[model samples]
Target: MLVKNISVVAAFVASVCIMPAQAQNNTIVVKANQLKADIQPTMWGVFFEDINMSADGGIYAELVKNRSFEFLKPLAGWTFKGKERKEGDLLILNRQDKQTNNPRFIQVNPNHTAKGDFGIINEGFRGMGIKQGLRYDFSMLYRQPAAGVKVHVELLNAKNEVIGKTTISPVATGKEWRKLEASLEATATEPKGTLAVWFEGSGQMDLDMISLFPGDTWKGRKGGMRADMVQMLADLKPGFLRFPGGCIVEGYDLSQRYQWKKTIGPIEERQLLINRWNFEFAHRPTPDYFQTFGLGFFEYFQLAEDIGAEPLPILNCGMACQFNTAEMVPLDQLDPYVQDALDLIEFANGDASTKWGKVRAQMGHPEPFNLKLLGIGNENWGPQYIDRLQVFTKAIKEKYPKMQLITSAGTDPDGERFDYLNGQLRKMNADIIDEHYYRRPEWFLQNAARYDNYDRNGSKVFAGEYAAQSDKTVSIHNKNNWRAALAEASFMTGLERNADVVVMASYAPLFAHVDGWQWTPDMIWIDNLHVVGTPNYYVQKMFSTNRGTHIVPILKNNAPLAGQDSLYASASVDKTTNELIIKLVNVSANGLQQEIKLDGVSKLSGNARHYVMKASGLDVENSLKEPLAIVPVEEQWKASGKSLKVNLAPHSVNVIRVKHLDLVSFKKAGKME
Candidate 1:
């Protein structure tokens, strides 16, 4: 009865095919038996950077802002009350000559503060979101002259009512800085809380690296990430996590390049630096943006492990950002940068007894992170890039020969610079060449067959960063709309079809804050206490979650379905699940029906499911108020015999999953066609 009902439903589905003046309903025949290539688990991933408050106010669970006295405006987030202002009274001293790495510290004038209790209040990052009964860890570096100065810390709510308090008095009289720690247990929950530090009966207290962290962070680590934010990433089930940056690795200048060593070690000692995104976008300037490195390399590795993803950390390759300074380090001085790469490997994979491994062990993860692939540089161009790349390739091969390396194809996916680098890297037999593209939705739809003609013998491809720009490149008016995600999904069918050539792909600038973002069309958006997955996020999620082991061809009239009547499709058979997974996209403005005939399988279970993501229009988008606006809708699909019919909704992405009957049943019905 079920088979009969499925057959009737399939006939109805096929009969509904209609033709319009603009386009006709197409028939997509899936050759389930014709196997293509295997899909790599690392095909889908995430690219993260510290841009747009992505780390401090976005992910890292440190509630206090400007915890370190390193921002250009030293006390940008702090307000002082009952304070005397005079020359040398409140000073920011830099010990650059001695403590070269950490140069800034606050020096309060003792003579001027003797009259009253001086208080410093931090407004936090858009005000702290404190929960009732939660504990907050507070720590700071202090250089005291005597035991007379008592620092009282208090957490205050909107009404200026203190919910928690702690006191710290420096007992020693010396110039050397000492670390002090205290904990506060909030009596009531307050979404917006402020921290106040009052200096009473003071002499002189020099402070730097002041910080506060919530106790309930991911994995309960003292200075770890926000549980909710990390949970969202974990839920996506990404295969790999590309860390540190897109442009941050190559700084505005070589002097400001991301130095991994400076990022590790004690939080107090991890020197703060200005984030490149601080002023990169003049139209959307964020002057308060800075990198404290609290969520540094070690944390990145830990995050990758926590989310069950491979860590792909790209390093500085003797070149700064080409768009800016195009600074280069001499060949002789390049050894340090090269050595950093070698040490990074040891830190990630070497035994505990090793030097760098010991530092990693001290950071709470003694076990190796199972380092595999390493990217040399990010989006560098010209002969200058190749020259330095050759040096790194030779050195890394001589040492860790088995370690797989990824090389960049400049700032574009094509043109002179990209063509030259691709040729050179291919000649070098580079393990994988990274490619990037940020194009219009129409461009994505047109280039759905971009890799169809790629040389199979050349270096493999890693689509390192990409997103469909809805408006224009770097446009402030761009959006993460349905049209962009739909186009990306259509292009992804081609990437899956050529899985043998493209090994990894991920969306860039994985996160953005609604109020603090500099980049548009990001994958995920977050606020202080909430996060919303854009339409693009769900599109990536669907493909990643249902990734099949082997690709299968879904053709029409013996031709690959690439924009045939505005219909795009790709099919794959999962070896583990013994199911046929077909992906389809309808870019047309009208609904269409397709008849997919399974050639190799005689019988498929009538029970199947269809997952469809559709919207009313191309411009539809998800908002914080309605986060699920563009999410998928799932329902059981009816099918029978070797022919299955499906109706494609207008401007939608669909995945149909069906189980294949065993060999015994298939052989029994061999002649039944």
Candidate 2:
């Protein structure tokens, strides 16, 4: 075949024969004139879960752990620093029969006690992240039965040296609990800092909901998300935000499943539940782990709005986690669960006059969230899930027909569970089917064409959660390395190529705390004072930011480049920006010279914006100390005669954007689309 007129790779040898492994075939042809499919707005997003201390001790900005003394071990995160006193001097009283939601409170009797003689220090979740000159706000529910009560607060570093100080005198003397708040500015910065409270000149005071937060929280909201953590999410410019999720939506038992109703309204009223991840590993016991619901449904919705992302909240169906309790509610008793789903839609998009919508307004969100997608379950399988889902589907559709429902394909991507659920959901004409995968890097590369032949008619696909496991699924040794990131980039090209079938996709297990993680290979890692976006995160950012308005075919030898010669490619044209955006993922460990032919092109900008990210080594990863070690490097490249001639670095994900002069001029002399 002669390429005198038709633009093709310079060295492109069209062959049906199978190329040897890692062969050097570096040819890619992007058909810019033809638009295949419209890329959905919610194509790439983020999946949030509360594992690895990502909630209570994480994104949730409450720095004080066990602030309400509600953990199983009532004083787990606290310590009595003063000399031991007689019985009844300090007591943990439970009002289980009265305040069922928050039944525990600490009572201190300091009759004739001098200042600094008795105090309790909170060893925040792995220590609080304190910044110099940043104000630390302290608040607690207190009741004083007598006069002469003063509370002293201090912030300490790792060496137990106080860097900040404040005092609170609860003058409200009565049996009823009253909320008291105060703020103190830190004089020094310490990533690992502690909060201490001294009971001084007190007759008797009962305290509950002892909380502290940094003044620099997101938007400076009193009790909002951590600024830096939320900034990482905002930086992604994500299409959607799936929240209050992962396994927490399907708890260890039905009795413990997340109840959205209980998570709304006042912070004091929000019921606290033991975190499902509490002490899962005997070797690394975290008995104090619990969900304070500080980051609940309202907060999740607000966060989505804050980050300019569509809210996709998954609710708890009538069944518990199949991997654990495998509990199910009788069909007759599933009414409440269905009602919860119906009410959530109202809470999100209902008018302010409606019941749940009023709750949204009362919570400072006067306008509706206008949520369009909702899921009933997360990773559940079997007929039990299907049955419960049937009820939920009927109810939600009847109430809000326009609302798109996401049905689960279960935990395994290709097991009997997935096949059965996938078949049933399609038969039911489900709007979207959620699929999850956590496999080796090779699996990702091999399955680069996963949705190539997926039916474009009925139920669309939602790659709800996926990660290329560096080791094995659920293995603590798995790392967020460059190899895994490259594989994911390769796989993602298929998702972009098949934009007609897969409407939504996201990377799973969004965050992990370096000191308190139970899961590895998270998109982002955080510690007391820092946030690190992994190489995988950079890949996501590169693709998402460059995601064009519509899909365009980028083929090699008239075939989609899916792992051939370890090169994967997808092309799109951004109608809004009048630019041709093409992504190339090179999996080889050695650099390769590549020629990209822009078929049916005439005139274009001389220089194109190029974003290239390459790992120094397969096993190398970004860390707290070196956050930008493997980040994308944005540069410019000059094109030659409407074609790009560039060298793709080994294990690199490259994005090239060429500005078109006009729709007509960018194509062949006689061609016009």
Candidate 3:
């Protein structure tokens, strides 16, 4: 039976004062017979991976081409001899002599061969997983010796079958390095593999700085981010963006850290660095490989501006340990990093007269950027973090006092340390306490109401990192876990109920490029070419985009169904359109058909717009092959009198928009009658 609002409110008030408060019995019902609400339009926000470009990492966006032929053997090798390391994998060779001079080219006879095989493998290729039928522009530097060289470039499928092949001949006596470019089309049959440059029957050849990219024709720009990729993220309508993070900012030491200055400016000068995460996982020797900061700080700011999102930049706190804990720097030695923070703020928000501000203007944006929030560090904690926070907080408060400061609390399961850290931050008057949660789905579901007991007077909360961990077999099969959905919904409800204290929130480790992921269960997963938004992405979108400025008291009728513990509803008025938006969540296994009757609102005579996110199974996800396996669908609703009955699917989120009728029209019609 549909429980009306008027009766539910009386029941809530009666239950509240008369009995002990419990999760199951905490239902509220309105007393008014008439129902009305003013719904407001919601804003959407998206997080961009910045690895090749910024912190959000993937090959397509990562700007620097790290693995070239810099490590190739000299004349002892078939292709070239005496390779001088350029950037990451870029190697330059001299062609003057073989013994005395470095041999840039090698003569490959019928029988004579080099010690190792020299052919393009997976190395040095970006966006290898790009979809077929897409156009990509390829560029590289090659020099020919006195004798010309012939090379065959083939796009091979996963099975090593050549899907597309092209041959190129370098002109004789090509001494200096010359730029060679070609446009390649990704065919429909092109399996997921590398576009290999095979040097067979080579006379003399030297190559450096090879790059291939999808064409920029889609957006009319020459080159940069893929247009379709950017458009997909833009459609999500992200509200805020947290830049350069998740262990990316917290480097081994001060030198290896992601310095904003190095990444800015032209691509030629930007030195590439080995990602700490990649280096650790690959077990490579050289950890501090220089990173070409091609997509620098300016790009991050520009991206935020372009997408109309609030920029949230994270700075390095004073922990020198690489993935381990370290002692904080002495107060005297901490000045440089602190100054770097100050300068970054100036670069983002200062006028032209300021130092970095002028540099920003020189970069084409004379106007100061809007710097809303600044995070202290990624996930390091302890006395060192606290000490560093003390220094950073003091300086930032003195300079940009209005800017919100966030500090990370260690991710300990007990949450005791987290609680203590929050207390410390509140004592220090920190603006936001960054807490990370990564637990099993069941844990999240059980603790969904954990935040209900939070101290309202304390600093705001930000769930910096969160996602369920799954085994390899389960992820590959594309199975949905109900535990995750339930946890997400429950946690989201806590955030909404405490929205006043939790002003800004975001899920961590947002994207994991198919091969690029070190952690499992990311919100969004993408390969070099194809992408998929995980179930968590949809859950986040539903809550974030439907949020309203003001929340109304919600009343529910009926005893709590066993196993279906709680229900929540909130209402808000859109001042601009005078429409009422109702967000209802039914955390139950059975569908809820409830009668909603709002009070203190009138003239409600309009069709309702309903948006629901549901799936046949809880574990369903959208993949690159099929993006619409699970998506939101909209429908129209007809209201009957002052009460509206809604049938909410089990374990589903529903947003209803009701446009309040105009009183003037009703008055005129009454007079005419």
Across 123-241, the per-residue lDDT of candidate 3 in tens digits comes to: 22233454567666666666566543455565667676666556665565457767777767766454255656655444555565455665653344433554545554555566676
TM-score of 3: 0.76
lDDT of 2 by residue, 41-61 (tens): 899999998898998899999
- What TM-score would every model get versus the actual structure? 0.90, 0.95, 0.76
Clashes of 2: 0
Give the TM-score comparing model 1 with the true structure, all chains together: 0.90
lDDT of 1: 0.83
Which candidate comes out best when scored by lDDT?
2
Candidate with top TM-score is: 2
TM-score winner, 1 or 3: 1
Q: Give the C-alpha miss distance for residue 232 in model 3, angstroms.
A: 3.8
Which residue pairs does candidate 2 place in steric collision? none
